[model samples]
Target: MLNIADVLHRWCRAARPFALATVVDVTGSTPLPIGTSVAVDEDGNAVGSISGGCVEGAVYELCRQVLRDGGAPQRAWFGYSDDDAFAVGLTCGGELDVLVQRIDPIRHPHLTFAFAEVADGRPVGVAQVVDGPEDVVGAMLSIVDDRVHGNAGSGPSSRAVADQAHALLRSGRTARVAIGGQADDCPQSLTVLVHVHAARPRLLIFGAVDFAASLSQVGHFLGYRVTVCDARPVFATAVPYADEVVVDWPHRYLEHTEVDDRTAMCVLTHDAKFDIPLLRLALDLPVGYVGAMGSRRTHQERLRLLTEAGLTQDRLMRLRSPIGLDLGARTPEETAVSITAEIIAHTNLGTGLPLSSTSGPIHRPAVREGAVMK
Candidate 1:
C-alpha cells in the first residue's frame, strides 16, 4: 500500500516476501477507508493497518496464513457480531472485505515497480483484480501517467479494466471498478481495485514568521509539500521546517506558481501591504484552503481593502480571516495546531464541532470516493 511504501520498498529490496491484506470494499460504518492495507513479513513483522485496531489481529493472522501456504489471494470479510462479543469483527457495526495475497518480486514484479515509484515520489497506480475468475484473481496492472504496465489478464477485459483504472488514477481515486459481466468481449465479471499514489499536495505559507515555521512543520507532518515565502530574505531563510524557502513578494510568487484544488494557501503576513495584494489573488484561485492570520480589527480592515480592490462578496466569503479554529491558542505551536485543524476540517467538510456532540459515522465518505484528495 502507498501508506507503507517505504517499508514495502525496503522489504522488496532485501528480497523479503510478505503478505499484504488490503481493504477492497466496505459497507456501513467503518473507521478506515477502502484501500487501507496491512502487510506481514515471513518473520512475523508487520507494517500498516487495515482497521484502526478492531480487525487488525484477525487480518494479521490471515496474512500469516497466506504467507505460510503461499497460495492464491484469499478474501476475508469482517463485520459486527452482536451474538458473539468475542468474535473478530468491527465493533463499530461495519463490514470490511479484505484481500490477502502473498507478494514477492518473482511473482508480483509489478508491485515491486509500484513500490519503487511510490518511494521515489513518482505518481503511480496499481489496479488489482480483487474479484474475478480464479485465474484472473490477484492479477495486477500498474499505471504511470499514460503508460500502462503489467497485466490484469490477457484479453479485451484486461484492456477495458486498464482504461478505467487509468481514468481513476488521473482523478486521484482508489475505487472498486466492475466490468465484463455480459459484454461480448468478456463474459466473466471482474472487480478491480484501483489504488493511486499521487504526488503530495502543496501547502504555500506566505509570511516566514514564527507561526509560519510552526505551520510548515505541521503541514509536512500532515503530508503536504510545504513552501515558506517572504519578501525579506532574512526571515525566509530562517524557516527550517519548510520544504522550500523562497524570498519573493507573496503576490508575485503566487502569481507564477502552480496550484490546484488540493493546494492550501496561508497568508500569515498580517500587514496590509503584503496581505492585500496576496489575498486578492489567493481568494480568486480555486484552492482547497485560503486562510489569513490577523486580529478582528485587522480582518475587518482587510475585507474593506479587498472589497475596494474589486473582489466580490462571493470571493471574499472564501477567505478565512483571523484564521484557525477557536482553540484560545496564544503560542505559535498551539496556533499552528489550530490552523491545521481548521484546514483539515474545511478540506474534509467537518463541522468543527466536538465529536461528542455529533452522531452517526465518525469518518464520513470522502469528497472523492476512495481517496481523500486534500
Candidate 2:
C-alpha cells in the first residue's frame, strides 16, 4: 500500500496535478471506513483506494475533471444501499461520501504539514466542517499528528472536546462531532469530523520464534506498524524481523515506547520470566488489546506469579492471557490466524457471532469524538 502522505509529498514536490479523494463519511455497510484516501494523477494511475473497486472508475473520471481544472475540489456521493439520486453509486449496496480535492501545498500549508507528519509515521487528525463543495472554510480544526488546534471552548466544554479528539486520534477514528452546549454559549450545533488519517495501529510481538516471523508478515499486511521486541539479539535480528525488529528489554521497552488505544501487544515469548514482566508493563499503557500466548496451565501459573508480584485485581483483569481466541489452533499458521482473529475481534469489539446472527448493521459506527459523553 502506498502511504497516502508519500503520495501527497510526491505530488507537491513534482508540482504535478493530482486529485485527492477521501472517504469523508460512510453511512452504511461500506467497504472501507471514513478517512480512507486515494491519490489519482492526471493519468489513470492511482495510489490508495477508498472502496472495494465499487466507485473507483467513477472517482477516477471525476479526478480527470479535477486535474483539468487545476485540481478543483469536488464532492461525490455514492450510495449502493440508500435511495440517493446520484448517477454513480456503490455496487455493494452501501453509502460513501468522497471528498475530491486539488492539492496545492503553497495554498494550504496545514495540508502540507499533515502530509509530512503522516509520512513521518505519527498518527494525526484533520478536522473540518464542510459548508460547501469548495469549503476549506470552517472552524479550521487542525490536529498535527495528535495535537489539537482551534478553540475547543472553555472550562469543561473545551477540555472535554479536546480530550475526546486526542483520544480519537490515538485510536485513528474519523467522524463528525456536535460540539458547543454546556452551561455556556459557544459554537453550538457545528458538524466537525475529526479527520484522523495518519495514526498507524501497533503490532507488538513479544517472542523471537518462527511463529513471530509469520505473524510479523501478516501484521504488516494489515497495515500495522509491526514491532518485534525481544531480549535475545540472536533471535530478534534484522533477518528475522526485517525492518520491524526491536532488541530491548521487554518490560523496559514499553516504558520508553508509547501505546494508545489503537495499539495491540502480543506476548509470544511464552516464558514466564519474559511474559510476566512485559504483560504487567503493557497493562499500564492505554493499549486497546493485550494478548499473551501460553497453555492453560501456564496462564494459571502466570496469574499466580502476577499476584505474588503485587499486581492488583483491577490490573490483572486487563490481560487476555492464553492470548488469541479458542480456535483449537494446533499449528503455527493456525495459531497466527487465531491470534490475528482475536486482535480483529477485540478491535471491532465483536461478539464472536456470525454476521447472519446479528440484526444490527455490520459496520462500526462513525467515531464521533473520542471521550465519553457523560
Candidate 3:
C-alpha cells in the first residue's frame, strides 16, 4: 500500500513476497482512514498500521494466513461485539472491512510499478478488484497521469474501471467503485477499490524562525512536503525539519513555485515589509490555508496595508491572521500544535470545540460525497 510504499519497494526489489491488509471500508467512528494498510513479510515481520493499536493482532494473523495460503486474497470484517467481550474487534464501536492480499513481482507486476511510482513522489491510483468474478478477483491496474498499466480484468471492464480510477486519482481520494453489468462486453458486476496515492501536499512556511522550525516538524508528521523560505540566508540555512529550505524573498519564491488547493501557506514573518507583499500574493492564490502569525494590533495594521494594496474584502476574509487556535500556548511546540490543528479543522470542516461537548458523530462526512470509504 502507499502508506508503506518505501518499505514495500525495498521488499519488492529483493523479490520478497508479502501480504498486505488494507482498510477498504468503514462504518461509524473508525480510528484510521481508508487506504491505511499493514504489510507482513514472508518472515512475519510487519510494517505500518490500521486502527492504531486496536484490532492489529487480528489483522496481523490475517496477513500471515494470506501469505501462507499462497497469495489467496481474503476479506475480513471487524466490529465491536457486545455479545462477546473477548471477540477480535474494534473497541471504538466502528466496523472495518479489510482486504488482505499477497503481493510479489511475479503475479502482481502492477503493484511493483505502483510502489515505485509512489516512492518517486508521483501521483498514482491503484484499482483492485476486491469482489467480483473468480478469475478477476484480486486483479489490479495502476493509473498514472491517465496511462493505465496492467489489467483489472477483460479489455472492456479494465478500461471502464480505469476511467473511473482516473477521476478519483485527480480528486485525491480513496473509494470503492461499483461497476454493474451495463458496459459492453462486461456482464459481471464488480467492486473495485481505488486507492489514490497523490503526491504529498505542500506546507510552505514563509519564515525560518523557531516557530517555523517547530511547525515544519509537525507538517512532516502530518505527511506534508514542508519548505521553509525566507529572504535572510542566516535564518534559512539551519531549518533542519523542513524537507526543502529556500533562501529568497518569501513573495518572490512563492510566485515562482507551484501550488494547489491542498497547499497550506504560513506567514510567520510578522514584519510589515515581509508580510505585506507575501500575504497580498498568498491570500489571492487558491491555497487551502493561508495563516499569518501576529498580535491583534499587528493584524489590524497588516489588514490596513493590504486594503490599501487593493485586496478585496473577500480576499482579506480568507487570511487567518493572528493564526492558530486559542490554545493558551506559550512554547513553540505547543504553538505549532495549535496552528496545525486550525489548519486541519479548516480543511475538514470541524468546529474547533471539545469533542466531549459535541453530541453528534465525532468524524465528519467526507468533503466530497463518496470521496472517502464509508
The digit string of per-residue lDDT tens for model 1 on 59-99 reads 99999999999878998999988788787889888889999
Q: Model 2, which residues run further than 4 Å from truth?
A: 1-3, 38-48, 63-74, 81-87, 109-113, 120-124, 132-172, 178-190, 197-199, 231-239, 242-249, 308-314, 353-360, 366-374
- Give per-residue CA lDDT, model 3, range 1-374, as digits (tens): 68898898888888899988988888998887777899999899999999888889999998998888874689899988878778787888788889898887777776777889899989999988888887787788999767899988888888878887899898777888898598575667889888888878889999888898899999999889999999998888867668899999999998999887888889998989999999999888878889999999999999999999999998999888799999999999999999999888888877899999887667554453211111
Greater-lDDT candidate between 1 and 2? 1
- State the lDDT at 121 in candidate 3: 88
lDDT of 2 by residue, 230-293 (tens): 9999998863433478889899888898776777888988898898888777776677778888
Q: List residue ranges in candidate 3 displaced over 4 A.
A: 41-43, 67-72, 144-146, 184-188, 232-236, 363-374
In candidate 1, position 44 carries an lDDT of: 99
Question: Could you tell me the TM-score of candidate 1?
Answer: 0.91
Candidate 1 overall lDDT versus native: 0.86
The numbered model that scores best in TM-score is 1
Write down the lDDT that model 3 would get. 0.86
**Relative to the true structure, how large is the alpha-carbon lDDT of every model?**
0.86, 0.69, 0.86
Candidate 2, residue 109: the lDDT equals 60
Per-model TM-score versus the true fold: 0.91, 0.73, 0.86
A best-first ranking of the candidates according to their lDDT comes to: 1, 3, 2
